[model samples]
Target: MVTERDKELIGALQKGLPLVRRPYAALGERVGMGEQEVLRRLADLRAKGVIRRHGVIVRHHELGYRANAMSVWAIPDERIDDLGEQLAGEPGVTLCYRRRTAPPAWPYNLYCMIHGQDREAVLARRRELAEKYGLDQWAHRVLFSGRRFKQRGAWYRPPQPAPEKAEVRHG
Candidate 1:
């Protein structure tokens, strides 16, 4: 079970650090903690793998990356590791990993995220990758995100009962 402090720390991390010279300190002030304590708790959470990484989540489109696609590749099961590493090392390829292929309807195992300023640029890069890696034989598709519904850090709060005052009193 997470302690109350832990819950607060999770909330803070989920919301994100404030844009300031001493952002943690500002967050700590809001939650009745000091900057050092906040840092300590963050370190502890990361060490335990509760937090994978602490970094900014940028708006790619706002930053002029109008085209972003999830590119899936059908790589041989035996060569996934080597090919995944190679794909990840490529410029503008932000993410790459392997997933179990879905039958009949979906048949891609390897996935990578590619971002560019426009559809043509992204497609051009994909073609370049296809040629460089001899991926023409492998089936692939680029699925662009139609809309962004939720793109925030994980919320780690547990359910709570109604506030005692609200439960007990009537105006």
Candidate 2:
């Protein structure tokens, strides 16, 4: 079970670790913990599913990517996995994942985000992708983004967890 200190550590991590050689040590210093303790706590948090994913998140717009497009496809159920992987490998394809298809309403199961400096360049890449994958025969759409807001990575650190009942055992 998570405690107050665990929550504090998780909350601190939402801002990201320091860009230093001894990042854990820096975190530990801030949290009144030893370096090893911070590492152990982070590992424990991951094991307990408190933290789902750990990685560096880049803000593409800040990095000079002026335009972005979400190219969604109505991929066949059997072909989604292979095609999704192939799309992920393409240059400028920043994000790729599958979603549950809402039949008759929305059939787009495979999705990818392509980023570039120019909208036309992004569209050209999309066309190349479609041609390379023969996506014209399949249903696909490249919706160029006009504006972006709140594109930061998720901050999973909650201030306080909701109350829950846990069974107690006495030895």
Candidate 3:
């Protein structure tokens, strides 16, 4: 069960951690908590499944990686784990995972993202990975991103206090 303090902590976290040497301490100050206490509470929340995951949302374009391609492949179910592990460990592959096939329309299951300074570089990297992993043997496609979408963390709002009732007297 989440308490009022937990709600406050979640609300503060939704805004993203402050860019500081001691980010947790900053958060602790905001919620009237000690840094160590805040850390322990966050761990408890995670253990109770209140917090599922914590990750970074990178803006590749600002970092000079303007080109992005999502290379998808339809690999044998049994081999996906092995191939995915190999490709994910390679350099230039920023994201890699498996998704359920959409069937007749989309059969691709395994996917990996490659980001580079230009389209040529991204394509070359994809080709190198494909050839090195024998990924070309399977049906695959490289879809270049034409645009980017806003990325941010999840939001959690605090509970609002109830309004006080006005007193009434018979006139």
Candidate 4:
């Protein structure tokens, strides 16, 4: 069961947080808890699988990595697990996951994110990955991010109170 304290944390996350050196301490003050209590609860939540992870979200593009691509691969069913782990071990590949491949429509089954200084650099790393994994026989593609819509921390909240509606009167 979700407790009231959980709801409070969720609410704080949804409304966003203040930018300060001790942000958690400020958050604790608002929620009637000390900074250590806040940190302890967060740790407990993670241990119980209530939260996956808490970390900084970096903007790769802002860091001069202009070229970003999602490189996907279709590995033989038997080799998927081994190959995925191998690719994940690569330095430049940040994100890697196994996905279903819809043949004739979608041929890539595994996905990895590669960010680099430019297109040429990204392509070069992709080539290195393909050769390292011996994926010449497998079909693959690099899908670059044309645009980003919404990227922010996940917000957990209950149904919010709706805004007051204006009354309409017929003349």
Candidate 5:
């Protein structure tokens, strides 16, 4: 069960920890906990599978990856997991996952994001991925991003209190 302290930690994390050498320690100070306590709690949460990872999320464009595309493929449903893992292992792939497809219309299920310095390189990498992964047989599309907005970690909100039911007046 989540305790009040966990809620406080989550609430503070929503705003993002300060950018410093010791981010967890800084986060602990913001949440009124010792650095060791913070690390201990985070480790506990990880052991329980509450949080998947603890790391930095960089803005690719700011880091020189000026062009990117969300490459999608319509692979056989049974082979999706296998192919998704393969795509995730590729060098240029930044994000990879499977999505539900709307049949008779939208067909792609496996999706991944590829980043590069320019459009040409991005497209070239997509072509190489198709050839390397034997994805030529499947229908796929590479959608180069026209614009980027809202690139940040998730903003976690505090859970709202459940509303109390009112007693009915017999009169």
Candidate 6:
């Protein structure tokens, strides 16, 4: 069960940690908790499965990776697990995962993202990966992103209150 204080801590987390040498200390100050207390509470939350995991959203363009391509494949269901794992471990592959396919429209199920400084490099890397992993045997497509959307971590919202019980009067 989340206490009121935990909610306060979560609120601070939703704002994103402040960029400082002692970020946890700063975060604790905001939540009216000490650094160690904050850490302990976070650890407890993780142990209890209240918090799943943490991740970073990188700005690839700013980091000189201008070309971004999402290479999707229609791998056979039986072979998808092995191939997805192999492709995910390849160099230049930033992200990889499986998704549900919409047949007759979109048949791609397995997806991997690769970023590079230019389109040629990204495409070449994709081709190499496909040939090296025998991914060319499967139908696939490389879709280059034309624009980037804003990215941020997950947001937490407060739970709504239950409705008050209605009292019925009897004559």
Question: Which residue pairs clash in candidate 1?
Answer: none
Q: How close to the true structure is residue 49 of candidate 2, measured as C-alpha lDDT?
A: 79
As a whole number from 0 to 100, the lDDT of residue 158 in candidate 4 is: 48
Candidate 2, run of 10 with poorest lDDT: 162-171
In order, what lDDT does every prediction score?
A: 0.76, 0.77, 0.81, 0.75, 0.78, 0.80
Task: State the lDDT of candidate 5 residue by residue for 1-171, as single tens digits.
Answer: 667787677667754567899999999987789999888888887888766676665766889999989888899988889878888888998888788899868899888889999999999998998888788699988888886674444344556332222211111
Task: Kindly report which residue pairs in candidate 6 clash with one another.
Answer: none
Q: Runs in model 1 with CA error above 4 Å? A: 1-4, 146-155, 160-171
Q: Write the per-residue lDDT of candidate 1 for residues 4-85, one digit (tens) a residue.
A: 7866666555446788999989989877899999998888877887666777667677999999888888878887788889
Model 1 TM-score? 0.80
Flag the better candidate by lDDT, 3 or 4: 3
Report lDDT (Cα) of residue 108, candidate 6. Answer: 98
* Tens-digit lDDT track of model 3 for 1-171: 988877777767765777899888999998799999889888898899887655565666888999989899999999999999998899999889899899888999999989999999999999999989899899899999875574443334466432222211111
Evaluate candidate 2 by giving its C-alpha RMSD to the native, one decimal: 7.8
Best by TM-score: 5
Cα lDDT for residue 40, candidate 1? 89
Judged by whole-model lDDT over C-alpha atoms, candidate 6 comes out at 0.80
- Tell me the TM-score of model 5: 0.81
Question: What does the lDDT come to for candidate 3?
Answer: 0.81
Best-to-worst ranking by TM-score: 5, 6, 1, 4, 3, 2
lDDT of 4 by residue, 21-67 (tens): 98889888877889898888777777887765665556677999998
Off by over 4 Å in 2: 1-5, 19-21, 43-56, 149-153, 159-171
- Candidate with the greatest lDDT versus the true structure: 3
Candidate 1, poorest ten consecutive residues by summed lDDT: 162-171
Relative to the true structure, candidate 6 reaches a TM of 0.80
* Better TM-score candidate (4, 6): 6
